[model samples]
Target: MIQLYYAPGNANLAPHMLLEELGVPHELILVDRDNHVHRGAAYRKLNPNGLIPVLIDGDLVLYETAAICLHLADTHPEAGLVPPLGSAERAHCYKWLMHLTNTVQAEMITYFYPERMVDDAAAGAQVKAHAEARLAQMFDLIDAELAGGGPYLLGAQFSVVDPYLFMLARWSRMMVRPARNRPALGQYLERMAARPAVVRAFAAEGIAAPFC
Candidate 1:
């Protein structure tokens, strides 16, 4: 069976939800992140970047959350977590997934770990504040897109991008202007949170309510 290395509420969330959505037999391996196990040599062998998520399938060891999501979607095409390849919908799916991981997730990293980007404690605070502001703009644009064409990012189809978006939005739950405050985006999150697959994933990870 497939095994997913994870820490609760970490980047592994999107893939975990996808696994549940796919109804595939999989094993969840806790990484003990709070004890810094992810930074250890063994974990580094699995993912040199020491990231929270790593997927092991047979002999393949995959890291990178977006890549894992795409792989799962591709391998389980019947589930339609992604659109048909070479189609416009598939292209759009790629677009949104890229935007979520490359753009939004990067900014979130800065917001949560500003010290990595700056020299002093004061500078870290400034970096975090600026990152939060940028995240707001990013989410605002997403909200506008949802306002025009949602129920899902691709409009009616529940794609891999939706779970990725939900995971990122949940990271902002403590912000002054959280992602849930936006009208369309807030509704989108509620819909995602209500999904049986999403609920199962959260429960398996021991994540409680106020999910977004």
Candidate 2:
């Protein structure tokens, strides 16, 4: 059986949601962040960065949230989590996935954990405010994409990208500029929250309702 080491609501949530979407049998190995289990030597051996998620499948050990989502989608193509390889839609998948992981999510990290970036406690508020402003613009770009063709990022069809997108959107639920504050993003997120996979993932991850 595949094993996914995870901490609830972390980047691991994306893969957790996808696994639910794929309807695969996998083990959830919770890495206790409160107790520093993820930071321990054993966990570090599994992931040098001491990340919350480390996917163990047969002989392959995968880290990185987007990489894991891609792997699960590729391994089970019948689930149709991604567009067909070499297709135009497939190219867009790659584009948005990279943008999510490298750009949007990176900005989210700064928004939530400004202490990591700023030295002074007072500066942390400024850092977080700046990140929230940047995220508003970034999410607005996504809303623009939706305005053209949406309900999902790929429009009509739900892709693996949605899980990562949903995860990031959920992160902003408590932000000063929460996703639900925007009309397009609010409707899009509500739809995602109602998905069976997302519902199941929330239950498994022990995340309570008002999931979006």
Candidate 3:
């Protein structure tokens, strides 16, 4: 069985949701980030960076949300969380996944928790403004993508992309300029939030409903 060390209401929610979606047998260990549980010596042994969403599967241990999501998808191809290699759609999935992790996720971190990235309040505010603008643009792009009548990111078929996109969309609400204006994106969020896997993830973490 796999063991996932995570915290509620954090980026770790992405992998937690993915694990739930996959129906994988795993142990969920709650780490108290506020209390510095991740910073402890023992916890650091698992992940020197002190990040949440650390997955321990037998002798293998992994960190980073994107890497964890992809690993689970690859390990369980029957779950259909990812597309197979060499397919056009697979390329598209990889493209968006990278974009979400490198672009949208990074911008969100800067805007949502500027203190972690910079010390100057004025500089932080400026950077946050830029991030907010980029977020708005990204939300518009997502809305357009889903506007093609998607019950999921890649149309009718759901994959790990949905969970990853859902996580980023949820983070958008925390931004200074929320994505509430995008009706399609807003409705998409509602659908993802209603998924049983997502519900269980929030409940497990003792967090309120994400869409609520």
Candidate 4:
């Protein structure tokens, strides 16, 4: 069985939701971030970086949300979390997955939790403003992508991309001005929030429903 060491209300929720969606049997091990449980010797032995969402599959251990999602999808093709390699759709999947991790996830982390990257408040604010502007632009791009669509990032079929987007969209609400003004984004958030897997993930963390 796969063992996932993670913290609720963090980026780890993305892969946790994916596992739930795939109906894959796994153990959810909650880590206490506030108390620095991840920094302890036991966890560092698993992941030197001491990050949450450390997936242990027998002798193999994985970190990083995007990597974990891709690994799980590839391992369990029937789950349909990702498109198979060489397929045209797979190209889009890889593209957006990278964008979500490097672009969307990067800016949000800088803006919402600047202390993680820097200590000076003035410097943090400047960095956060830059991130916020970039996030607004990205949200617009995502909105345009869905303008002609019904649901999901890549149109009809859902995949691993959904959970990543859902996690970022949830974080957007924490921004000074929420992205709710963007109609497509708002609709997409609604769709993802309605998913049973997403709901269960939030519940497991003892968090209130998405977007309050």
TM-score of each: 0.98, 0.97, 0.92, 0.93
At residue 121, candidate 1 shows an lDDT of 79
Best by lDDT: 1
Q: Of 1 and 4, which scores higher on lDDT?
A: 1
30-120: candidate 2 lDDT, tens digit per residue: 9999999988999999999998799999999999989999999999999888998899999999999999999999999899899999678
Q: Which should have the higher lDDT, number 2 or number 3?
A: 2
Q: Per-residue lDDT for 25 in model 1?
A: 98
lDDT digits (tens) for residues 1-212 of candidate 1: 99999999999999999999999999999999879999999999999999889999999999999999999998998988888879999899989999999999999999999999977878999999999999999999999999999899999999989999999999999999999999999999999999999999999999999798
For this target, which candidate reaches the highest TM-score against the unseen true structure? 1
In model 2, the Cα lDDT at residue 129 comes to: 93
Candidate 3 lDDT by residue in tens digits, 126-190: 77787789889988998998888697877777887788888787777766657656888888888
Task: Arrange candidates, best lDDT first.
Answer: 1, 2, 4, 3
Estimate the lDDT of model 4.
Answer: 0.85
For model 2, the stretches where C-alpha displacement exceeds 4 angstroms are: none
lDDT of 4 by residue, 39-121 (tens): 99999988898878799888889998899998889888987777777999899999999999999988887887776677776
How high is the CA lDDT of each candidate model? Answer: 0.96, 0.91, 0.84, 0.85
Score residue 96 of candidate 2 by CA lDDT: 96
lDDT at 35 for candidate 4?
Answer: 93
